[model samples]
Target: MRSPADPARLATLLEHRAHRLRRDASAQAEQAAQRDREAQTLRSAADKRLQAAQLGEEHGLDRQRLFERLRGVAIARAHVLECELRAGHLQEQAGDAREQEQQLRHAAAGNHSRARRLQAVGAHIDQKHRQARLRRQERQIQEEYTCR
Candidate 1:
């Protein structure tokens, strides 16, 4: 029931939305990557501190110093865990954005396909109208000749 141009307009709107989603997805992915890098850095630092704490423990270091090193290791490990959690959350957000982009793209493709079909139908209708006009003109010319 839609006009030939309707689908085209709808397609344009859908394509714009798809483009926006893709841009958002790209931004989200970049943020996720940065978060992941930070998480890795935190994890590396935590691992080194933990390893040092373990070595110190084996050496039976002074009780106070040992407890302080252990506490430092614990704090570093907690920071690493927190960073990892944030990275995971950011990755999930990126994934969601990408999924939305894909959905928008699919909708845009469907609208474009519909627009093409509508245009084809409109062309056929115009051709039929032109043919009918030519037939009427021929009939009028034949009648005039016969009457003359």
Candidate 2:
């Protein structure tokens, strides 16, 4: 049988693992948030460009080339905005997945610790039973010798 200290060591190791997982998960979340903020800024810039383009297109009917240029600018901005949003969404998904993995790891540690505790309790009970039986046998021997 392993020493009582084994479980404590295992628990400490598991705790360290859990802490690392949590730290990594938090870092991923922070990175995702940064990406989201960046995407929002890009989206805002695209919206402004689109608004400016629309205004310029509506202001002058004679400037056909200017209107075309504005339309092109709006389209380019829209594409860039989509790309930024996609990056943010992908990063968010990655972060969420990492967090979920961390949660699973934490649950696994809890389960393992609980199972170990139960096993230790069972072993303790068995030891107590054996000692009780030995005591009973000694008492029976004494009683029999005295009766004789």
Off by over 4 Å in 2: 1-5, 56-148
TM-score of predicted structure 2: 0.53
What would you estimate as the lDDT of candidate 1?
0.66
RMSD of each: 4.6, 5.9
Query: Candidate 2 on 1-148: residue-level lDDT in tens?
Result: 5566555455556666656666665676666677667667767676676666554425445678776776788786777678677766866776676677667567656756665775577677668879999999999999999999
What does the lDDT read for residue 123 in candidate 1? 68
> Evaluated with lDDT, which candidate comes out highest?
2
**Best candidate, TM-score-wise?**
1
Taking all chains together, each candidate's TM-score versus the true structure is: 0.62, 0.53
Would you give me the overall lDDT of model 2? 0.68
**Model 2 clashing residue pairs (backbone):** none
